[model samples]
Target: MGYALTFEGLRDLAEGAAVLGTGGGGDPYIGRLLVEQQLKAGRTVTIIDAAELPDDALVIPSAMMGAPTVFIEKLPSGAGNIAALRALEAHLGRTAAATMPIECGGLNSMMPLLLGAQLGLPVVDADGMGRAFPELQMETFAVYGVSGSPMAIASDHGDTGIINATDNRRMEWLARAMTIQMGGASYISDYPMDAATVRRTAVPGTLTLARRLGAALRQARAEHADPFQALAAALSGTLYTHGLVLFRGKVTDVDRKTVDGFARGHVTLADLADPRDQLEITFQNEHLVARRNGRVVAIVPDLICTLNSETGTPVTTEALSYGQRLTVFAISTPDLMRTPDALDCFGPTAFGLADPYTPVEHLTAVP
Candidate 1:
């Protein structure tokens, strides 16, 4: 069946989405706040389990593209996001029966939730990538053979356009330029497909997982418990099963910049107990790779996330800074993302990392 997200339940959902966002996906604070406001005004957001989607139902997977840094400065013009989906519907010659998050990390997760509420549509209870990835082509939708063409890109200024390309990568390239022109951030709805395809492409239960993760954190806080332990336990059996504390330290250095409309940077963490044993985390919006004392401990396709050691709050790439205390956690990528085909598309080589791809399950020995 389906369920509605209540205002009271938002804390768990937001915190969980941040953990799943893997240190990217932009912060979920704005998204959560927006949803809370809507619910406070008596609006309802319904989420249907992926399996509940009818075989022929139309589902549009979407995301907000551009630097997370820019999104903060440029709040979306609500109509522009809905207009993009409407534009996609126009191109497809049909109305969408539902919407799905392209990736369930940070603000992007909130876009679909908020949009669904605005459009009075039910959101599928799953997402393309269980966690967030940096690019549009990094989704299970593409890996499972769905084309993201005949897409729609819209800006907050009532400007919308349809893009029909031969592949997903080209669409991203075209849409990216448009986002830059639209003032560095825009809403994009692509990979529109049917429920059958959605069941195959979507990472099941992620929305619910995000909620539970958030709830656990909230409970931990109430009891003055270790939120990190709560988070690890929450992720133990999902597709993101292999998760463990990789390092606990104080941030001593940060190098960041906006490159090609993406926030790219690395942070250095010095162990609180043994200052000389440092951990280096490199990221392109999302945390992508990590090394501990010169040994590669984690890499792309696996999550490398940092939480405030004291409060269990997530600290994304754009927010990393010096003297901040942190606990770094590594969570395995979904099984759908670990295959040979999926790996070639988003693995180390694809990200320009010199080392060959190695599983975090193997690298850090989470088992």
Candidate 2:
């Protein structure tokens, strides 16, 4: 079934997408405002399940490519997304039946909605990554043999370029360089696929999941209940079924830098009760690995999220600072994302970590 996103629902979607983003996707607040502006103008953003898409329909995944830290300061011009999509459509010689998110995290999650509202096209409720990742090549679409090019990119100023790379990895490298030249960030439309391919490769129902996650957190807070508990219950019904609160503490140190078109660094947090008990999280645009007291509690391909300890609001990597109370939560990703082929693309070693990939459930079960 298909439905229109009311203004109220957009808020919850952004909130939930941020949590799933694991502190890497661009600011959801900014993305929310963009979508809200369109909705206020009486435009409707219709969301259809991937299964509802016609087999031959064209779907273009849209997103912002750049460091989330840079995106905070250099706001998009709003025209860039449309420009990219249009350029891609021109190159492909076919109109997009719909636009969809490349990742269901932070700002990227909202980019397709914004585009769909502006273009009056439906937005598919599926995405390449169930969560956000730093690099462009790290997507389920690419993992399942979708080429990243015939891709298009556009800057806030409407500067546009098309990439026709030999491989997805090369496509990312080229796009990253172009993003830097386009002033640290740009809008992109890529991995143009038929609906049948989307059904097979994309993570389905993430948009709905994000909305549900957001509603759960909001409802839990309204009832003065444990938001984490509510979050777990919400996950219990979704494809991402495992959720755990790994640590509760205060930020003690942050070593983040914007380099190579990424927010690369790590954060350290001390147990709220014991200064000696600490958790360290490393990231390259997203939380990739987490260690507590010298033990690996979580690693990539799984979700490592940071949230406000009390309010349960998600905190992005760029927002992490000293002395803020926080909770680090881990959730298991879907089985499709853990296969040997998928691991080859986004495993712990993919991020330069020495540890082997371990399921969050198994890692958390450690005494």
* Highest TM-score model number: 2
lDDT of 1 by residue, 1-367 (tens): 8989887666677878888888889888877877776677788899898678779899997678888888778776566768889999998999999998999888888888888878788889898888888888888888889999888998878889999987888887888888889999888899999999999877888888899888878889999999878888888777778777889999999999998889998899998888999999988889888999989999988888899998888888878889999999888877888889888877887789997778887987646
Candidate lDDT (C-alpha), each? 0.86, 0.93
Write candidate 2's Cα lDDT for 225-316 as tens digits. 99999999999967898999999999999999998889999999999779999999999999999999989999999999999999999999
Backbone clash numbers for all candidates listed: 2, 0
Q: Which regions of candidate 1 deviate over 4 angstroms?
A: none
| TM-score of every model versus the real structure | 0.97, 0.99
- Please give the lDDT score at residue 317 for candidate 1: 81
Q: Name the candidate that leads on lDDT.
A: 2
| Model 1: per-residue Cα lDDT at residue 86 | 92
Shift of residue 197 alpha carbon in model 2, Å: 0.1
Residue 141 C-alpha lDDT in model 2: 94
Clashing pairs in 1: 12-214, 12-215
lDDT of 1: 0.86
Q: Which residue ranges in model 2 land beyond 4 Å of their true spot?
A: none
User: Once model 2 is optimally superposed onto the true structure by TM-score, how far is the C-alpha of residue 159 displaced, in angstroms?
Assistant: 0.8
